[model samples]
Target: MISNIAELIADRIGTMPASERRAAQTLIANYPMIGLKTVAEFSAAAGVSSPTILRFVSRLGFQNYPEFQSSLQDELAAQLQSPATRTLNPPSPGGGTVSPMLEATLDNMRETFRHLSDKQLADIAARLADRRGKTFLIGGRFTDPLARYMAAHLAVIQPNVFHLAGQESMWRDRLIDMGKRDVLVIFDIRRYQNSLVRFAEKAHQRGVQIVLFTDQWLSPIARFARHVIAGRTAVPSAWDSSAALFVVAETLIGAVTRQLEAEGAKRIREMESLR
Candidate 1:
């Protein structure tokens, strides 16, 4: 499936020519900041000529720069477009002291944090602390890195950690090895993939515990998840924000670390000694 714009850019970056790839890299690294800037400003920052940037946009299937910016800006407006915020519309069009996008980000965080609880954190931590079977982290096109990030820290402190590949063939290969004792963590966002939803459902039927991290719209797979962690919604943009989902990953890592306690500390020391 075609991913959101940000994910599309990231997916294509490796195959792009040197100049275009550099331009893509700069935006990925500093998205909202780079996204809001004029084409000239962004092109200059990427060290490419202005026209090159426009071509890059076209490569991503955008009709023009404003269309690109509007997609990016949508992520900012999406969350704050709640009835109250819209009805009580701010006096200015986000050009004053507070950037509307920034405000939306704060709102997203607040909502995400508010929904999180000690019990839920501890439950996920317990699942990670269990050593019987492998821990599998599965992230889709846009969220694969977050899954890998989760695998990285969990692997350091624990015995079995695996990052599941996102491709259909590779994903099924990985799923075949999973069983009742294993735990599966998935990260999925909007423009959902039906195949992935089916994968999650199959995993659930196998009795593997599922932990899901997703955006506000909620994945259809959430129903099958043993634990569902929802991210705050971002404003509408050519790309969407996983900022809230990212925090969820970090928090889970922290909780897992705490749960491991003395065992975790000992493992870290041994790992450090090997370096």
Candidate 2:
């Protein structure tokens, strides 16, 4: 599975013809810096044909160049957010013209759902339905909203759902007591937080089951996760479009809710009667 977008592009370059490799190299170097204005604009900037850009993207497992570029931009945003790294390019339209951000968001959502197989969705739902254990969500920085959203929805539908609270130190304290019976749901996409990865690793050591919602299969946090669900966050700007992530989050919640309603309706009815 492709891990990082850069590695995907590099692999494509290795197999591509010499001329295409040069174009790919140019695109890689200039991307997230100069920013991709459009297909024709990128073609001119990369000194290659638009068809070559399409091929490069296809080689990376994307349908076309736009998809590939969007993913790259998302990854770049993640990395640039780190205090150690400076953002090379500010979030701005390269051609001094506004591009359709909403269109890109809708396209990303469409592709994300298209690529998600029914089996994968079912599997995730099953994981969430494991009522034998507690579900704990861990997310930091840009992804905190996702974790909070999932945890809140799950809490109402499923018992024993917990969102990691407090500062990093508080989370660390809570992690010290976590064990295998607990499920750790982590959201770590581009510009991933190191603390989240550490939490996953520690949780893994305790035999905790991890479910990761991230941008790619090769995300570092995926290494220790039991289940990894991929979501497309690439957008026209430096920051990722959360539309895809939100869709997946809602899907997971809906599936889990339906499962509970089907299998645990009697329990729910009893509890409601007492209330």
Candidate 3:
């Protein structure tokens, strides 16, 4: 969710002590362009001590220097692969620059898929296929489209699929009313919204089953959720690409739909006749 590191730094710069402002400025100015440069490298570039860099990261809400660097690297990688960057330096005829971008996206997806165990998928499939539970799909801001898509697709083949959208004031309290028989499926990526976290926390307190689809295992909301499915979508264009996430969402819905068709077809027909 940290789309522009510079902008993020700038927004928070006023809160930082005057001593750290210069280091913060340096990060804002030359973040995505710089590779995996160490804190020492950044410190030298910013004409500050490494400890100052550490403080700068802490001030920005990162747990430590290493965590800050990891987040920055992900943001930088996305920025570099953005279409705007590619357009700035067009490849020569038949040079095939797009291959690298494509490969990077595929590699990310492969790593994410590898990280998921069969047991995890099976458990998630079971939850999604459960007819007795109400499935609440929640996403905010940039990820809202993903949640809506999943909810709509699943609704066609499953019952009790709900998409939580619109203003938080209107839906937040209602969403929390879900209980143990309900599952909350939340999609959150980097630069995640605070409101989503609050909603997840509330849902967790109510004993609702929580399924999270996110970019990394280290996501802050992961702890509150019952299941975590890592979506290794490419980070490009200062925006996280949800291509892989969408694929996973659809695949999950498809699996659950198949199960429902196999297990509940007769009941589903009876219910449909009542409607």
Question: Candidate 3 — which residues are off by over 4 angstroms?
Answer: 1-97, 263-275
TM-score-best of 1 and 3:
1
Say which candidate scores most in TM-score.
1
True-structure lDDT of candidate 3: 0.77
Cα lDDT of model 2 by residue, 116-192, tens digit: 88888888788789898888997768887899999988876678889997788888888766788888988888788
What is the Cα-based TM-score of model 1?
Answer: 0.64
lDDT of 1 by residue, 1-275 (tens): 43356668867888789999889988877865797899889998999998888988888888998998888778657635764554223434546444666677778888998999989888988987898888999887888899999899999999889988747878877778889999999999987778789889988988989999988789998999999998886764457878778877898899989888899999999999999
- Which candidate tops lDDT? 1
Give the range where candidate 3 is weakest over 10 consecutive residues by summed lDDT: 86-95
C-alpha TM-score for every candidate: 0.64, 0.60, 0.60
Ranking by TM-score: 1, 3, 2
- For lDDT, candidate 1 versus 2, the one ahead is 1
The sequence of per-residue lDDT tens digits that candidate 3 reaches over residues 148-167 is 99888788777788898778
Error of 3 at 205 (Å): 0.2
Which pairs clash in model 2? 3-218, 78-191
lDDT of each: 0.84, 0.77, 0.77
